[model samples]
Structure formats: C-alpha cells, structure tokens
Target: MGVIAMDKKQITLYYSSENSIGKQLNAYVESSGKDHLTIDISKTNVTGTQWAELADGLNKNISDLVNTDHPDFKEAYGENSVDLDDDGWLKILNKNPSLLKNAIVIKGKDFIELTSASDFKQYMDPDSAGIEKPY
Candidate 1:
C-alpha cells in the first residue's frame, strides 16, 4: 500500500489538468463539497513506488494505467505488441506521466480510475449513506 494513497478524510485525485475529462472530474469532485487533494501529474512527479501501489490498489497492471493509444505513446512505442512487466511499465509512467489513462480517485482504502463524469457516483452516491435532499 502507498503511504500517500490513503488520506484520513479526503479525496485524492491523481490527474492531469491538461485534459477536458480531468477538468470535469475535478469540478464534480469540487462540487461535492468534500475535502480533496488534487495531484496534477503533468506538473508533479509521482515516484515509481507510489505509482506501483496505486496500480495495485486499483487491481490493475501498471501498463493498464497508461493510455497506449495516446499520440505520445503511439509515437514512442508503436502498437506492435510491446509487452512489458510491472517495472518496465513503471518506467514509462515515471518518464511520461501524460500517457496515464485517467484520474485515480483514492478515498480511504478504496480507489477508482475515472473514465468519465458518470463514474463519479461510484464514489459519491448520496443514497449509499442515506443522505436525503434538503427539500
């Protein structure tokens, strides 16, 4: 487990502000009024160990955290069945964080990879806690 992956009472968003989806995700989380920590990977450097822990926390392979179809990825490594182990994939992430697929929201001991705005409910469902409308 990553030491940084778990916060006591806040949502940790690992994302790049350079993308539209990421922007929307940030806004949604902000609107929730929950305490949050945003890590803009584009400007921040996440260590290899932290990245590995995040991947494991999400039950995914390190390569699965990458957008292999991204232009940068395609340019650097053509889609020629390039296979890499965990450490090898971590190197790619360490060197080029932009290739990351999506935001990773870590809350408590749980984490989810945000693919779209609709995915927010998984972490923010009001009914889960029986939070009624103020009406």
Candidate 2:
C-alpha cells in the first residue's frame, strides 16, 4: 500500500456585522483561487442544530489535512486577545470544535477575537470565562 497525502484545507467563517466584512472576505478568497464555505448568521435562521451541522461538515472535510498558517487568521483574531460576555456566542463556540482557528466571533460591529482550537475550547464557555484572564 502506498501512503496518501491529503491536501491542507483552509476554512474561514466571517461573522461580520452589516454583512460587509464577510462578503468582502468571501470575494477575496474566491479571487485568490481558494474556495471557502460561508454561513450567513444574519440571514439564515441558524439554530443550534444548523450550527452543529456546519461544524460537523467542516470537521469531516478537514479531518486528514493540515492547516496552513495564513495572514487572515491574524487579521481576524488580532495581535492581542479579547473578552466576551455573551452566553449565546460562548455556547456556539464551545459546541463547534472544528471552528477553532477558522472561526471568528463578531459582536454587532466589532470583531471579538480569533482563537486557537485549544484556547477556543478552554475559554469558550461561560464557566470557563476565567481562562480569559491570562490573555
């Protein structure tokens, strides 16, 4: 049997307010010869189930691939970290493990932060909010 090499897949979720940033990012990615999947939280009736399904699909798609470090990640998350108080956002983040690095949390008109998969899991829950202290 021969060893198989999987392509590294990049996933980005743009949760921008007014739908501007997300749209622009989508276009930019597409023009750059990279395809991306998007979920419009503002237009879609994105229930917990829908979010779960999206997360599951993304996880399955990238299961065997590595992540390429891109400047977009830093741009989305910023050089420093952020603090959040919304339980709904926390719940969504905690439940979607695949969304770690690719996922971004936008609060109204502001981008909360970008998180690593591990850090995302650690500080995402309301109960785990204390983890934000170190950052």
Candidate 3:
C-alpha cells in the first residue's frame, strides 16, 4: 500500500503599516516557506465580528506552527509583540479593530475587516516571505 501525502499550504499575513506586529508575522511566515497572503484592510470596511475571526485564525496558525517541532517556529513565535494566548489573541483583534473602528466611527465611515486567514494571506508575495527554499 502507498501512503498519500497531503499538500501543505502556507498562510502569510501582511499589513500596510511598518513597525507593527503584523510586519514581524510577515517576516516569520516568509522565512518558514509557508504560502504568502496579504490583506489590506486600510481602505476596506469590516465588522467587529469579522475582525475577531481573522485574529482567531492567525492565532491558531501561529500556535500550530509553534507547537510543531519546526526550528524556525520558535523564532517566528518569539518575534511577535503580542504573546500567544487566548486572551492575547483577543486583545490583538480588539485592538486592531478598535483602532480602525474608532477613527472610522468618529468620522462616520466604515471600518475594514479581515474575514479569514486565507483572505489576508493572498496578498503576500511568496518571494518576499523568504520561503523559497526549505530549511
């Protein structure tokens, strides 16, 4: 009998701003040979619940990679500004949405929401992620 191999897909998260945790995550995902995806929420409108879902997916992805025995996972996990925990994940989601929501709400505009991990990851350039060669 032959064993079947599942195709591994990498997810990358990108943000327009620099000097933020999202940038660090982008670097991490790229170095890990994972698929690159980006979501530009800068001009998009999103609901609070949608933001929460995106954050949850990111949190889960990081957790899964870190828990694996992959060497690069440790470095990637450590590079984040937010610690890996349920509360921490929620904090990130809330903070990001709140930051955008507050500005938009005050101006009576809609805020952008990241719906899913894949939605965000689709924007990253694979080469930029630095995952060209497996370690």
- Which candidate has the highest TM-score of all? 1
Better of 1 and 2 by TM-score: 1
Q: How accurate is candidate 2 locally (lDDT)?
A: 0.37
* Model 3 agreement with the true structure over 1-135: per-residue lDDT tens digits: 112111235342424332244444445455756454444344334444544444343343322221222234335345444356655443433334222211100001112223233423433334545522332
Q: Could you tell me the lDDT of residue 96 within candidate 3?
A: 41
Cand. 3 TM to true fold? 0.28
Off-target runs (Cα >4 Å) in candidate 1 are 128-135
TM-score of each: 0.83, 0.30, 0.28
Q: Under the 3 Å rule for N, CA and C atoms, how many clashes does model 2 have?
A: 1
Candidate 2 residue spans exceeding 4 A from truth: 1-7, 49-135
**Clash list (residue pairs), candidate 1:** none
Q: Number of clashing residue pairs in every model? A: 0, 1, 14
Q: What TM-score does structure 2 among the candidates reach?
A: 0.30
Error of 1 at 34 (Å): 0.7
